[model samples]
Target: MKSTLNSTSESATAAIFLSAVLFCFAPVCSGEESSNKRTGEDIYKQFCSSCHVAGGNTAKPSKPIAGSKVLKSIATFQEYLENPPGHMPYYKTVVNDKSMVRKLYEYCKKLKQTQGA
Candidate 1:
């Protein structure tokens, strides 16, 4: 019985260690691969909202891009705005760097959440 208890404790400890490692490294690695480091929210405001009009882009092919219709849900919106297509013009030349891109992503995500669309 004591041996079984020890084994269970060891498993629990390993699980906790793995979880901590994942939680810590997830954000770090995510920052590495992505081009635009700005949070989705900042990126949207800097590039999308200004001309998007009503916080939504209705310029052409992509109509009212910054709205609820743009994304099925709030969480999804955050993910999509992170890497806008080339049609939108690459922020790399302007924003450059990865960290800035992440911030931009965060900003755009916030705009969508606040605009309620």
Candidate 2:
């Protein structure tokens, strides 16, 4: 009777632990979190603002994004981000998909228009 009770207690503990772990990761795994809801501006502030501030590149002043040809099209912008040159970091993981790339591209284009560049 004692061994059976201990076994049941251990099984209950394991089940609770597994449930907690799964609950913590379920949102991330299912793509039902805020990461999917972040806007282009949010992404820019989080990842790009440090270097590309207000459409200007602090690292490479001559290559400001305000009027660059990279924003000519979504393909060009996505390609450049995935395989950037100079001091730019590769954003394959952050941008990750077409929707994210499109959002960033639109934001950059808007910046260019607003900045009159």
Candidate 3:
């Protein structure tokens, strides 16, 4: 009876230890990857909102990104993001990742569709 109790206790401890290890090591478990993930709206609000208002109006003299030729595809969007013409500063760190750029692109597309642009 005592041996049975000991084995059960050992099994429980092992399970807990394994779970902790997995939680620490697993990518999804640690939330490291998802922490960097940004929604399309989030990206736009963070980076482009000041220049490009809702419905894609230009707050300044800059061209509106919504329905712009550059935003037609992710490739053009990324290219413009990296090296835009005129005075717009490069967004290397802000929209560094392709996924991040895609989020911004999707947001622009949605805005264009909704606003009849």
Candidate 4:
């Protein structure tokens, strides 16, 4: 009888643990699912517009992000954002993900193309 009770208890605990794991991962799965739905312009306006407006900001005197050569290369742009040289804040938390980086790069590229830069 004791062995039977222990087995049942273990099963119950395992079930609870599995439930918790699934619950925690649900949001992450949804986030990934919706990531592609966001646009480059939406991402820039939400995250980059604070510091970079109309491509450049007076505070830094840096080149406009829209037409900057670095923006042309996603790898270089992601690297720079990961560890910026100047006063620009690190975007490791925001645009660090591959999807987000791609979106931001495409947005800048579009801006550059449209502006004929």
What would you estimate as the lDDT of candidate 4? Answer: 0.74
True lDDT of residue 52, candidate 1: 69
Tens-place lDDT per residue, model 2, 61-115, is 7788878899999989988998899899987656687777777888888875233
lDDT of each: 0.55, 0.81, 0.72, 0.74
Measured with C-alpha atoms, the lDDT of residue 105 in candidate 4 is 84
Angstrom error of the Cα, residue 31, model 3: value is 5.4
Model 4 residue 114 CA deviation (Å) reads 11
* Clashing residue pairs found in predicted model 3: none
Candidate 4 per-residue C-alpha lDDT over 2-59 given as tens digits, one digit per residue, 9 for 90 to 100: 9999999999999999998888787555555466677878788878878777666544
CA deviation > 4 Å runs, candidate 3: 31-37, 55-62, 94-96, 113-117
> Would you estimate the TM-scores of all the predictions?
0.36, 0.66, 0.68, 0.61
- lDDT tens digits by residue: candidate 3, 1-70: 9999999999999999999997888776665556256698887777777767774545443466656788
Q: How would you encode candidate 1's per-residue C-alpha lDDT over 41-106 as one tens digit per residue?
A: 544556766656555655443555544454555445444444665555544443444455445544
The 10-residue segment of model 3 with minimum total lDDT is 55-64
Model 3, position 49: C-alpha lDDT score: 74
> 1 or 3: which has the higher lDDT?
3
